[model samples]
Target: MYPTLRVRVSRIEQLAAGIKSFTLQPCDGGALPAFDSGSHIVVHMDQGRMRNAYSLTSALDDRSRYQISVRLEEASRGGSRFMHEQLRENDELDIGAPANLFGLGDGAGKHVLVAGGIGITPFMTHIQALARQQASFELHYCFRNRDSAAYLDELPSTLAPDQLHLYESDTGGKLDIDALVASQPAGAHIYVCGPQALNDAVVAAARAAGWAAGRVHFEQFRNEVDATGGAFEVALRKSGVTLQVGADEPLLRAIEKAGVKIDCMCREGICGTCETAIIEGEADHRDQYLSDAEKAAQKTMMVCVSRCKGKRLVLDL
Candidate 1:
């Protein structure tokens, strides 16, 4: 794990009805760390060790401050609630160094950005970079309505009128993923950060239209939970312990509950810190960090999200 940096909140501004942008500066009064176009900082929330990842929205070259936006989500895992209600402008917090898994590719000449709701935060940096390089790019933002759109007030001033497109579902405006994918130039690359449904739709459409997998980029944030999680038996070969993991419990939690501690950073499986060798059984890989070749090999699995393809599985743990 990288060393944590202590930062102080410099300012807070409400961007929308329930969305607010926070500006953070180094508490020690030093320059903040440099970041890439689409980097994210992990915020350690409250005292519960709840780590929440927020994309950096401020300019990449600027070290004066780092900005991150948060939407109040009462139904969420309390991270958003802490940011909206408990966090104050002068509050000090510990944050992780910049990490990028969804950064822009320099080789891609034309860029197409598709954002849903708060997903536009990461693309703010990308937009500035594209403008500086005088590259061809377009942004399509999909929101529930005007009130739910967080960055509308600033986007118009920052982006050209022809480059930005807003689609409001409440007003019968449609994003039309199929049509959007069909309309893109053959070599143009697409960057997506949004809800699972929106991401899945874009990926599916791109693949169906014969777009290469390398040309499609996405930011993976949360743990994947479909209806497929079922009770499975895990065999810890090194410890000679067998544990039953329930549908509601993550594999890491089950292992920890059995008095086994595995070194992990991001439990969402995007960090690849909890990856373990698969002694036996087919792994139902669900992590965004692993490549298709690695998943097909079935030599390792991220214990945090992956499950056993069959009833029982053995781990080197």
Candidate 2:
């Protein structure tokens, strides 16, 4: 369970051309919730529960503040625009308690970290943790140009030469995904956070290099599911209710209309917050969070992006 707290934006700085970073602190001047590395808080921005989950970029030891970077995307759904334009310093806003889907690998002494664009947010925690522990680690950040990449100046100054590498496409610097994975030791763990293409490429390269499944970690920040998907009927077993979900409406929204509230962190289905047991129907799973084995099992489905394969479906809700 996550508690909602009101926090004031202490500072807001433009990190890049399109990105703005905000520093938030508790309104009451009390200690904020303690969080592990790679945690995020859900910011509910509207009456319809329009929320955006942002990675906490501040260090874990910094209990006085929490930082989040927002990119003003051209195709944003108003969340980024709201933060970039309407939100200001000294304004109080509601944010959820920190929750981590990506935790540091303590058992592995050697770590390889990869980031693309804003995916660098969560890795700040990982880098700090590894540096504090004096563990062996390397980070590769891929971006189109320096102006577009957030934390461009900050990371290089903080990290040593052997710790960080920046690959700027504008400078003709390319990342050899295949070679990078092959160079890592067998005991090393590889973690990546990026767009679909980058994430897929890294995972594929690592697997081809014989990296075990357990040794590879990733957190996809984008949800590429098509919103104009076909809809169907859903049956709630415990509630004894059935609702008709329109083709244009997401399954999660349909369920919410029927008075079933499922706590959702990232509505994009990447966080696995809305996974529900499938009582007796096939689901067209469109989420990136589920593993191959989980998808093959067909026991659960992520309602945020997934839909029914047939006319009717039963859920353990």
Give RMSD to native, each candidate: 4.3, 2.7
lDDT tens digits by residue: candidate 1, 232-279: 999999999999988766677688778887866566777788899999
How far out, in Å, is residue 132 in model 2? 0.9
lDDT score for candidate 1 against the true structure: 0.84
- Measured with C-alpha atoms, the lDDT of residue 46 in candidate 1 is 89
Q: lDDT scores for all predictions?
A: 0.84, 0.84
Which digits, one per residue and each the tens of the lDDT, describe model 2 over residues 113-209? 9999989999988888888888899999999999999987788887998888989989998889988988887689889998889999999998888
Per-candidate TM-score against the hidden true structure:
0.81, 0.88
Q: Where in model 1 is the C-alpha error above 4 Å? A: 223-266, 271-273, 280-299, 305-317
Model 2 TM-score, 2 decimals: 0.88
Count clashes in each candidate, considering only residues at least 3 apart in sequence or on different chains. 0, 0
